[model samples]
Target: MESRELAYFVAVAEELHFGRAAERLGIAQPPLSRAIQRLERRLGVTLLDRANRRIVLTAAGEVLLSEGRKALTALRSAELRARRAGRADPRLVVVMKPGGDAGLLERVLARYAEHPDAMEVEVMICGIGEQEGLLRDGHADLAMLRIPHDDPTGFATEELLTEREVVVLRRDHPLAGRTSVRMADLAGENFPRWSEECPASGQVVRDTGQVAQMIALGQAIAVLPESVTLTLRRDLAVVPVIDGNLTTLLLAWSEESRSRPLAAFVRTAAEVAAQARPAEIGA
Candidate 1:
């Protein structure tokens, strides 16, 4: 009926003698006997068979003893699990438009590795619209973006870096040999196409003003992250589009978590982006 009653029942059940059970429980024999009597009264069952010289369990006492021990064990296990959950690390979610440079991805992962309090991170690669939706809905803690969302009144964006957009053309294309090409030069060439099959191409579609598939057909040129072009296809030549040279990449989040580890990650990422910029564009 109560924890104390169950404890008294168990103590007497195990020791099988009133004097010894009371000693184990740190109580006098008469009080221990009274507690067990109270438990049997609540359960409406006889628990022990007692004579002047000896004590033994009735069938009912044996049954209650088995179940009470099991219940105590389960209670302890649940407490331990709850404590573990309380101490677990926080998870960081990163959302971005699909297609990332492999080296940049590696660098981001490395920075997270250095944090002592890091938890498991879930990386969600989606279109800009989806990334914005996740941040607004609380599904993502942070996002990397070409342009930060403007609708959410509580959100804030930090400009991480402004890096040049590059033209990715098949190696044999005429302007591919040039050190740089302006956006206007490739007005009608069908450039790289975006499909689930080509993630790098998909990002080119989402970020640039031009149609990506039309660019792939060589009637236009595709513009993409200098990082994407640098890491993806060896046969594609990436050249900065002179006047078209830059895109402002930002790290965005809700104002509440802006001071947390998510912000720390944003700072680390800016360093990686600046270091990776030069090797990615001209040579």
Candidate 2:
């Protein structure tokens, strides 16, 4: 019913650990538990199933979590509309894949900073699955994703860049000095496979964290987006994949988002991509 209650529910649902949720919300565990209890009482439904050492959401909790996020998104849009009408200010929401190109976003912000209207751009790190959901549910105006989206009927997509896959290895590895590497060369190498929940999972990786750890330990080779590999551990050497294909990074949004600040962002991204000259582009 209240925004604070919704916030508490979301926090707990995300963490699933009472103490951790409390810590994340900047409160003690007792009050957090009490708040959950109150929320359950108010809704007349059990939201969580708690065991000795674990907590899991009930079906009711799952429904609430989904609807609550939609409600919160609508609230944000309402606030933005009010702000725009009163002060000629605009706001844009963008969800990005983790370890994405911050430099590119920075360029867009710098280029659009001189606009007459006051504007705010909110950026959040989200998974690939969440990106399209966020936009369709009105929580976000745009998203940057690792894989190319196949469906583009009601949405517009701009090919920002294609990032080469690179082999990440420890400096001590024998293959570190190679000008380029191949996946087969690391056949026996314990690749960093991404978890099924990870964005890169099932794409070209085995396990994301595990592979990263192996690469860090010089036990196996891991192939990752050049942008991501470069941004991660500097101790790891990243060499282009001589025969590997690249992942296409794209900017996508619904057509309805075109009239809002999202349009400005679309244009800014195009300009920034041209100026940055990231990797290669295809027709």
lDDT of each: 0.66, 0.70
- Over 1-283, each residue of candidate 2 has an lDDT whose tens digit, in order, gives 8988898898899889888888998999998899999999999999999977788999999999888886776677666545644655446778775555534777677776665542688787775346666665566667776663323445688877776688888987888889987777766666533445544322334224445666777666667676654355767787888887777777888654536456777777887787664542111
Q: Pick the lDDT winner.
A: 2
Candidate 2 residue pairs in clash (backbone atoms < 3 Å) = 192-211, 193-206, 193-207, 193-208, 194-206, 194-207, 194-208
As a TM-score, model 2 comes out at: 0.59
- Could you say which candidate leads in TM-score? 2
Q: Which runs of model 1 end up more than 4 angstroms from their true locations?
A: 1-90, 100-103, 148-154, 191-220, 274-283
lDDT (tens digit, per residue) of candidate 1 on 1-283? 7767887888889999888889998999998988888888888989998866678888998998998875654455455434533555646778876553223656766876687645566688775346666665556777766642223445677665566678777677888899988777877655544444553333334533234334445555577666565445555567887877466666678664534566667767777766765455323
Any idea how many clashes model 1 has?
17
Residue 167 displacement (Å), model 1? 1.2
